[model samples]
Target: MPEQFGILTMGDAMITLNPATTGPLRFVANFERKVGGAELNFAIGCARLDLRSKWISRLGKDEFGRVIYNFAKGEGVDMTDVAYVEGHPTSLNIKEIREDGSGKTFYYRYHSPVLTMEPEDITEEMFKDIHIVHLTGVFMAIDRKNLDIVHRVLSIAKEKGILVSFDPNIRLKLWSIEDARAAYHDVFPYVDILLTGRDEIKSIIGTDDDKELADFAQRYSISQLVIKDGGEGSALYIDGQWVRKEAFSVTPVDTVGAGDGFDAGYLYSYLHEFEPAKRLEFANAVGALVTTVSGDNEGLPLLEEVLSFVNQEEVVER
Candidate 1:
């Protein structure tokens, strides 16, 4: 029998901003706070699907930190590994959304509590029984100490034979392109499942085509690689086989968090033994569904909802 499914995701969580009404930025723009982090989004997605998921990070003793702690507990996530610091503020991000739903984001995470994580925070004992350990490139962009922590966790996970999933959720504003390339290259050798976007690969490897991206990941010994191409579809290369699948058509309200949702759905299906083709299809559907709402993770469909959407009579819902 396969081991019980459990995920250990490490990253910073931030507050997201959404415009109250369609308009430009005046003296002040109405915004709401919502959880916005690639790894946190994945953890929330896993919890929504009733998976055993844990988020490991340091949070401040501020109000925002309290909010995050309460929110995660309320969402049914395991908070046993979260550390609370005395004199730091939780990371926060601001997003600006337009009428058409396209948006831009600014992050304020310098010297945040989570980036202060030390290697001792993650121990080999933590990986003794976990099924998969998920990470992203954003953590690498935080700071050197945090980057070392990520490497430490990955090293221990590998030694314990735990499945390692990596998402190159590259944010150009966070670091220089050179740093992104060097860090990703260093971490790719340890990744078992690599998830990245077509545009990200194009920016790093100068390729936008599916086959090139898939081949590049395979060249690094990554057995399973996925390239997520928004709207056009997604491609998957698993065990020396390649499969492509299109996404469900929907009027996008906000593109934020769609890719993270895709990762969540793909990991969910992967843990459940779904075929490669079906896994791509399911991930695409989940990503497309997230675009229908205005906030990150707000529009993510549950397991039943995703299955219903997949089995519906109509392919595209207007």
Candidate 2:
């Protein structure tokens, strides 16, 4: 059997509180606790598909932290590098889901445990078994200090000949769009695969023109630039050719983790040398399936589940 490819990512994991009912949080009394984070969600999604996944971050030495740590570990992600901080608290968020599945997250993270993580904490050894290093803007925006951490990981991944996949998951609740544009641009040169939202890239590059988007990719020398448009599907640019795929139809129960699932699906397909069209189709299926369920990584389908959907068979949840 061929060896499984491994991926590494770093970020904060939060204890997310889900509302019992949709609409105003002021009237909702019951809440369900769940674990979520951009980096962890991607890691979990990859692991679900049988990829080796290593996650690096700090969690508070508390119950909520333990919940998140145990959850990821149970999901088969490598949690050897995650540590428990003595004083810092694990991040938390309360979600408000609307009838249309769109929602807002209210953060209650004061002195996030991830801030305790230093740039120097990332070393070449961390990338030892990694085939890809996935980074997201959410972690970078959590603290400006994390940008250096991201750079360190990129430098080490580049040296190790590992692919670098990035997601500029713009979160205005964390930082302004201006800051995101500048910070993401600083790291674009190091990114080999960019899996980003179409609107996000447009906002960052200050243009929606396809030609300009291609020119920007050329400027960064990024080999695989994938533009993901919610519901409308996605487009990919590689070898100076463009490939577009339409979205799989699904009514979303929650849209929070669709991008992470899509990133995981694309990376999995790319690692296995799937064709560009298959990659986009598989990724779109993952994104669509994620919306059929709630919670962050819970909706991320397994390898078999995705195959059934992408192959046009009846989709079933495991």
Candidate 3:
């Protein structure tokens, strides 16, 4: 591990409006407001788990931006690099949740403040004392122009010898699969760890075969490949082998942000150098726990909560 345990991320934050009742957005009479963003959720999740989480991005100089900034700060996330822009309204999303707990997010991120971020804005000085840079596909998918910023950051991380962790949180609503593949291929060479979903990998590369996946990792020279299997558990590939763990049973209230929790758990464990199986177990537990609550990052647990949930001893060596 580096001299510091800080994890850095960048992306746009949005005000999420969830329906108060189970119905279509056209019929919903009431809604609950919350803050959400893939990278922001991961930062909050890491901070909750005792990691020094730092976020870098731009937000509109508006009320929604203030809410997101305050929320992340309240969660103990470092926001020294967050800036507010004028003109662009902060992005927002509307949630249409069904009776079965499934939901759809309608994004209103056009002219997003984050889009104003240029590749030149990312600098090596910004990565000082940062151990790992966590990135998600949602931000990359927001706009193809964002790819320049991502690539610039990856190059800096590489030059600084900082580990890079990526989550391909594919949102077809944002871009096409072909576009994702073309862009992500360039990113693969710079990534040190990959935290992805089972179905997502299939869509990204069109294969779920163990050998094929292993080959894919080898091609990218990725040291850690973690697959979130949802309720079935998770699978991890490291040190030339694979480790699988079953998921924890829980009554899910909302599954939205569970994967972000899983990424935080795994990266936290990886930073601590836990055994491979323990990493999967820990990540699975965090993901499971997130589903027990509503709102993004709301269910991301603190160190004590995770320890208790996993039935592990309280004093984990950091």
Candidate 4:
């Protein structure tokens, strides 16, 4: 009776500002608010791929939180585990986008409800129906209490034989590098699959050397190790063999949340027990699709769309 996937994360619904000319926030007039968060993006992508995904988070009882709630509900992500904390305000970020799609982000989440998450918020009953629990390193490195909550959830998931997927979505602006590294080390033992970028692996694991990366994967007993390289390709290591795939070509509108989309595509394929090469190819297609549109999760493709892109065919039925 377990759902296909459960995600534990914090929501930072974003306000993306596209000014006529990017200069300063004060001078900008045009701004658009969109629901965004790495975990939510992942959930939305999975849901679009026709997988049952539940997202867990704590949000403030405010309009911003409502925006995220309404968006998630509309996107088919289960919000049953999300809590509306009484006094806190929802977290938000402002990103100033240039014409080329690259942007700078400023966050205002110091007192957001998500930062106040306690271990008690995650009940034992929540995981009883979750086949896979997805976590991000950014939330794990937020603070000690949040880290403890992560440990608790990971422990319970392990006890129930649920697969644990970790995305080391490292955010250096939120915490120090040393702390992030330590937190990664602490959580590695419980991780069944690691979805991370190649640069991130080098920074956190202390080496980009092929042999060392292989040793690190072996040491952690990671069943599936996925290394994503933006626009270059992705490499997958499983069953003691390595499979590589080239990134799909696309004109990027906004690069944010592309990684989350990739994760969703791979997880969807994984649940269906696809071959490693097929999974990587599907994942790359999904990631590429995200860049075709603006916003975080706006460009997540459905199953047929991704299949069409991968097969180099056009959508003729529509």
TM-score of 4: 0.93
Model 2 pairs in collision: none
Per-residue lDDT of candidate 1, residues 147-217 (tens digit): 78888998998888898999988877888988889888888889999888888878888887666766886
Which of the two, 2 or 4, has more TM-score?
Answer: 2
Better of 1 and 3 by lDDT: 3
How does model 4 fare in lDDT?
0.80
For candidate 2, write residues 1-318 as lDDT tens digits: 978999998888999999999988998989999999999999999999899999999999999999999999999999999999989988899989788877788998779999998888887777887899999999999998888888888888888889999999998988999999899989999999999998888888887677888898999999999999988999999989899999988888778799999999999999999999889999999999999997787899999999998888987745
Error of 4 at 28 (Å): 1.1
Stretches of candidate 2 exceeding 4 Å from the true structure? 97-103
Candidate 3 to truth, TM: 0.95
Candidate numbers, best lDDT first, in rank order? 2, 3, 1, 4
Error of 2 at 146 (Å): 1.0
Root-mean-square deviation (CA) per prediction:
2.7, 1.5, 2.8, 2.4
Q: Give the TM-score of candidate 2.
A: 0.96
lDDT pick, better of 2 and 3: 2
C-alpha lDDT of all candidate models, in order: 0.82, 0.91, 0.90, 0.80
Instruction: State which candidate has the highest lDDT.
Output: 2
Candidate 3 residue lDDT tens string, 1-318: 544389999998899997899978899999889999999999999999999999998899999999988989999999999999999899999989898867788999999999889999987889988999999888899888999999999999998999999999998899999999988899999999999999999999999888898899999999999989898899988878888999998889878899999999999988988899999988998898889887787888887788887985453332
